[model samples]
Target: MSKANAHVVWHPTTVTKADRQRQNGHKSCILWFTGLSGAGKSTLANAVDQQLHERGLKSYVLDGDNIRHGLNRGLGFSTADRKENIRRIAEVAKLFVDAGVIVLTAFISPFREDRELARGLVEPDEFVEIYVKCPLEECERRDPKGLYRKARSGEIAEFTGITSPYEEPLSPELIVESGTQSVEESVQIVLRYLEERGIIPARR
Candidate 1:
């Protein structure tokens, strides 16, 4: 790396919250949903984004599979690739937050260390980790994309909770039990959290 590139100074600009709020009409945050495969992270994230849209909130979802087809195309399932994947996604999410938009990220994020690193890249209170808690058996039963089946059949390598590991969040901001809870109920839980935190206004 060039010394000039490494030694660039950051002259902070005075961009007030009022200015951003006026442009986007709300505060920005990162809603990071983490879990194993087939744990309904993507499903819940999309549902929550739809609810936010209906309530006039500016939000977007950075889904794992979708990202793999584009920004993270070169990444694979290795630990190093997974860390890099989350790092890139965190940077993107930070940009959205700066633009005053709520960014929802749904990824396996199997390692707690990687998740914590992502959180460290953003400002304090800007990231909210939501743990989608579902048992491995239940996740296999649901198997919306049949990924679990492939993992079990030895067709896939380094699958979380089977061939690899899944590190549960020690103190997630929110936990949704997707195995027992209905999708509607899960969405309501997330919405209620956002409303309670004043991220979204309460209904009149």
Candidate 2:
């Protein structure tokens, strides 16, 4: 059992999430982009974030390597560490949502249970799980980070698609075929989804 931190007390904010959302002029959500290393998850996420920013919407992206270099430093690629890594990211994303900003996360996030844990932290409609689907061969061929080479050569262990596993989402909110669709098309598809779902104002 875990010991409770009695020194830590709950502090309620006068300005609630609803108030922040009202001020931002739109609802907040988490656009979770999960896929293989070179599956264009980061590319698609950044593209979508750019459009949202251009539309004057509050948005931010939590990238994998960036987070590891900072907030998630010292976390390894073991099963438990990976779970902890995801847990920490999810908590941060939840906080961003509370602050009325759409948080787009681009991570391998190969496990469905970890994604579900994040999803459970928010409202049903607030978590948009976007599966950036691409075949393993294509991802390896287009390995932007050279991660595939490292993983294939045994330089990196517990890699998602090579050494480890990648369990696809059973029913994700959106599935962008990175292997088939262009980045611009994927961005438009996500924007259209936000509009159709009334998360943001429709384009005039």
Candidate 3:
């Protein structure tokens, strides 16, 4: 990660992204899922990932907790750490896109500036910002991870949507109400969007 090295060279691959896309029979893009915890971001992301896999499309899901287990392990929950976490995630997601895989990222990613930083890394159309719309009270009600409970108890600090804030997307490309709809319905909505946008071929 040190850019200070003078001998580093950018190596261009012979097989370009376009070639990879043609071989895979679909274009690659980033499906960025952002919401409060317990809002079904991970669930809906994996659901869509499963649907894509069933259709023989190359896709991957980068969940926040999972990523933190390795790639982002040392990072903490502070504001500076959160920004670094998102920056690294965006870079990695960009690599996945370049490799011709539709990468679904499920992260709270509460800051609009951070989200926009990710969006700016890719072609405008290749970045799909999915705002998983669910009220804070509803998310707290679900509390699948018990994070909200801990936050309320002062056991955890800087927790998004509780002690900290979640900046909702001002103009997300897609909005899915995971609070009300079934996961199946949400998956269908995403698939349809990809097809409609010509990111993937129509259903056969």
TM-score, per-candidate, Cα-based = 0.89, 0.92, 0.93
Superior candidate under lDDT, 1 versus 3: 3
Assess the local accuracy of residue 16 in candidate 1 as a C-alpha lDDT between 0 and 100.
Answer: 68
- Candidate 1 per-residue lDDT, tens place, 24-90, comes to 6677889999998889999999999998899888999999666989999988867788889999998
The better-scoring model by TM-score among 1 and 2 is 2
Selected candidate, larger TM-score, 1 vs 3? 3
User: Deviation in angstroms for 141 in model 2?
Assistant: 0.3
Q: After superposition, how far is residue 89 of candidate 2 from its true place, in Å?
A: 0.4
Kindly list the per-residue Cα lDDT of model 2 for residues 53-96, writing each as its tens digit: 99999999999757989999999877899999999999999999
Model 2 weakest 10-residue run by lDDT = 1-10
Distance from true location, Cα of 140 in model 2, Å: 0.3
Error of 2 at 17 (Å): 0.9
**Predictions in order: lDDT:** 0.88, 0.92, 0.92
Q: What's model 3's overall lDDT?
A: 0.92
Tell me the tens digit of each residue's lDDT in model 3 across 1-204.
Answer: 455656778554478888988999999999999999999999999999988998899999999667998899999977899999999999999999999999999999999999999999999989999999999999999999899999999999778988888999999999999888888888889999999999999998
